[model samples]
Every structure is written in C-alpha cells, then in structure tokens.
Target: MMDENDVKELISSYKNIKDRVEIISNKFDRHNVKLVAVSKTKPTEMIRILYDKGHRHFGENYIQELVSKSEELSELNEIKWHFIGSIQSNKSKILTSVKNLYVVETVENKKILDKLAKSLLNNEENNNNNNNNNNKKLNIMIQVNTSGEESKSGCKPEECLDLVKHCLEDNNCKNSLNFLGLMTIGNPNATPDQPDFKCLVDCKNNISKQLNIPLDSIELSMGMSHDFEPAIEFGSTSVRVGSAIFGERDYSNKK
Candidate 1:
C-alpha cells in the first residue's frame, strides 16, 4: 500500500481535480458531474490507499486486473467500480461477476450485451431464490466512435440510434442492461480547445433528441488523463482519469 504521505499527495491531486471540476461546472452550469479516478495498472495496495483517502469510485481498463483488484478489496462496500475499457464477448461473465460493479463504459456490440443481460438475469434469479444482496443490475454505456478511428471500438454516431432502439426493444435485454449513457475516447491528434470533444456532446444531444430519451439519464462518459478539463467543460457527466491520479505508469513491468 502507498505510504500515508503518498496517499495524502493523491488526495491533494484529487482535490485539485475537483477544484477544476468546479471551474468547469461554473462554465457549463452542471453541478452533478462525477470524477471517476482511473486506477487501472496501479497495484491493489495503492488502490486501498486511495480508497481510504475518500475516493469511492474508480475506473479500470483491463478485466482480469480489475477482477483481481475487486476480489482483493472485497471488504470495501462504498467503492463503485467502473469498467472503462473495451470488453470482449468471452469476458462478459467475469466482468459481470465483479462485486459492486456499477458501470461498464465500452459496450458496442449485441453479443456482449446479450451475455451481460443473461448473466445479470441469472444473478437476479439466484439472488431472488437465496435472498442474496450481492446481485445487482449492471449499468452500461454505449461507446460512440466520435473520432472515427478504425482501431476504436464504438458504434458510429449515425448507428447509435438503431442500436439503442434495438437494446431498448429487446425484452430480455432491456431491463437487465440499463443504458446509462454514451462513452468515447478522444483522438490523439485532437486539441483540447477544438471540436473533438464537442463532437461527442453534439452526438449525445442529437441521439437523445432523435430517440426521445431523457438527456439527463444519458451520461456522457468521455475524457481521460490528458483532457478531462475540456471534457468537463463540454458537459461530460463522468470523466475517466488514470495516470494523472496514479502518477506515471510503467507498462513494461507487470507483477
């Protein structure tokens, strides 16, 4: 675990970020924006330290790593886990099994959605029979390819309406997979002051209007370690931050 001093530094960093959130909130007039500290690649010990320091929500990119961390920190009830990475269909069960997992941000296909819906339904049924409190519906955010990158995994802006319609219409899938909002990653070449992030905001507005869905219910999950300020300014409800909170990451070394 991080030393008390390091934990204090981390908390200080978060406070700075929160202050930035306040500035952004004033510009946008939205005060409900939540900062999801991205803790992916950090050790469980560091996670524990941050948890103790008042950060209850975290975002993870890898399924295996997140599952391991979740198991290690099972004692902490207030931690709200968010899976902000691309998810494969084969890993849906593992993702769904995470205790107190509140959000999955990279949902683009029906196969993965079906797996999650089925798993949630099964868990709900099991919970009903055994009166288990552990079972809960998994919230999902449909990813949008605002950058139009070939490598990114998100539904196209034009295609999102159809997908949302299909997801809402499917009886087995609708209730189990709660569509909380939309998520997107910024293009590497895009500037923070430019329209790159605005595209996502525009997309959210158009989709919400087209579908006649409540805009408030649809969260815009964008931004990251580098450009979260601009993201917040663009009216993002939740921002996923990683290296900024955890310091520099050495991807070559993994324990």
Candidate 2:
C-alpha cells in the first residue's frame, strides 16, 4: 500500500493537473469539464487517500478488479465509480451492482445496452418492491472509434448517431440508460492537432445539435495520460486518465 507521503505526492500531482485544467477551462470559458482520476490498477489504500482528499470521481478499466475494490471499501458513498473498459455481457450484472457507479464508458453495441437496461430496470423494480435497496440510474457513454484503431472497442464514428437513436428508442433501454455523453480513445501517437480528437469533438457537437439536446450535459470523454490537457482545452467534459496518476503501468506483470 502507498504510505501517507506517497499519497500526498499523488494529491499534489492531482492538484497540478486540476490547476492546468482550470487554466484550459478559463481559456475556453467553459468550466463544466470534470477530471476523473483513473485509478484502475492502484491499491485500495491509495484510493482511500484520494477519497479522503475530496476526489469523488474515479475510473476503473477492469470488472473483477473494480468489484474487488468495491467490496473492500463498501462504506464509501461519495465515490463515483466509472467502468472505462471493454464491458463484456457476462459481467454486466456485477458491474451494474457496484454502488454509486456514475458512468460506463464503453457501450458500443445494442445487445450490451439491452442487457444493461434490463439489469437496471430489474434492479430498480426489485428495490421498489422491498427485495433490494439499490436503485440508481446508470449513466452511459457511447464509445466512438475516432482513431480507427482496429484493436479498440468502440463503434465507428458514422454508426454513433444511429446507435444513440437506437438506445433512445428502445423501451427497455431508454428509461434505464441515461445517455450521459460520448467517449473516444485517440490514437496513441497522435498530437493535439491530429484529426482524431478534433473529429470526436465535432461529432459530439453535431450529435448534440441534431438531437436537440443540451450541449452542457452532453459529455465528450476523450484523452488519457498522454494528451489530456489538450483534450480539456478542446472541450472534453470528462477525461480518463490512468498512467498519469498511477505512474507507468506494467502490463506484463498483471495476472
């Protein structure tokens, strides 16, 4: 576990990042963007420290690991859990059951959306009938394949509007799934001027306009450890940062 000093260093880093975000926000005159600390592989003790420091929003990229952490810290109500990985259908139930799950960042298909909608509705109904106590609308963000990465898990940009329409039209999904915004992972090597991120922001704007929705509430989730500052500058309501906060990641060391 990370000690107090280590936690302090992490908090300092977060403050620096937040200060940077504020500068970007002021430059653009938009203060609505949010910084979601990506705490995917960090230890629970580190997460507790972050929670204690008033960092309420955190993101995770794996189902099993997130569930394990949730169990270990089941009493924390102020934390918002965001599942930002490729969500499988089999794990939907457990993913939806986590308390205070603020958002899911990788819904690309209607099948998964249907499954999630049913889960949320059933959970709500069960809670209302006194069989359960958890009843909260699970927010969703449609993942868009802005970089055209073959290995990524998002719908192509052209298919996004139709999928959003489907999600809004489906009875089982409409009431349960709150279409919070759009998310994209830029090409790892791309710079701020790269067309990928710009294209995502454009798509987000067009969708919000065409759908006649409030632009402020429609999030544009993009950027990561590498290019999040520019992402915030270009109007990303939510940024999924991982390695920046947790330092470098060693994928080979994972089980």
Best by TM-score: 2
Span of 10 residues, lowest total lDDT, candidate 1: 246-255
Report the lDDT tens digits of candidate 2 across residue range 1-255.
677788778888888777877787888886767788888777788788878888888988888888988888889988888889988898898889887788998999888899899888877887889877656567999999998889988998888887788788889888888898899988888865867878887878788888887778778888787887788777788887766776776665341
Enumerate residue pairs that collide in model 1.
Answer: none
The regions of model 2 sitting more than 4 angstroms off are 131-134, 250-255
- How would you encode candidate 1's per-residue C-alpha lDDT over 102-219 as one tens digit per residue? 8998888777778888878877888889988665457888888988889988988877777677678788688787788888998867865647578777877887898898778789
Name every residue pair that clashes in candidate 2. Answer: none
Instruction: Please estimate how well model 2 matches the true structure, expressed as its whole-model Cα lDDT.
Output: 0.83
Candidate 2 backbone overlaps, count: 0
Where in model 1 is the C-alpha error above 4 Å?
A: 133-135, 253-255
How does candidate 1 fare on TM-score? 0.92
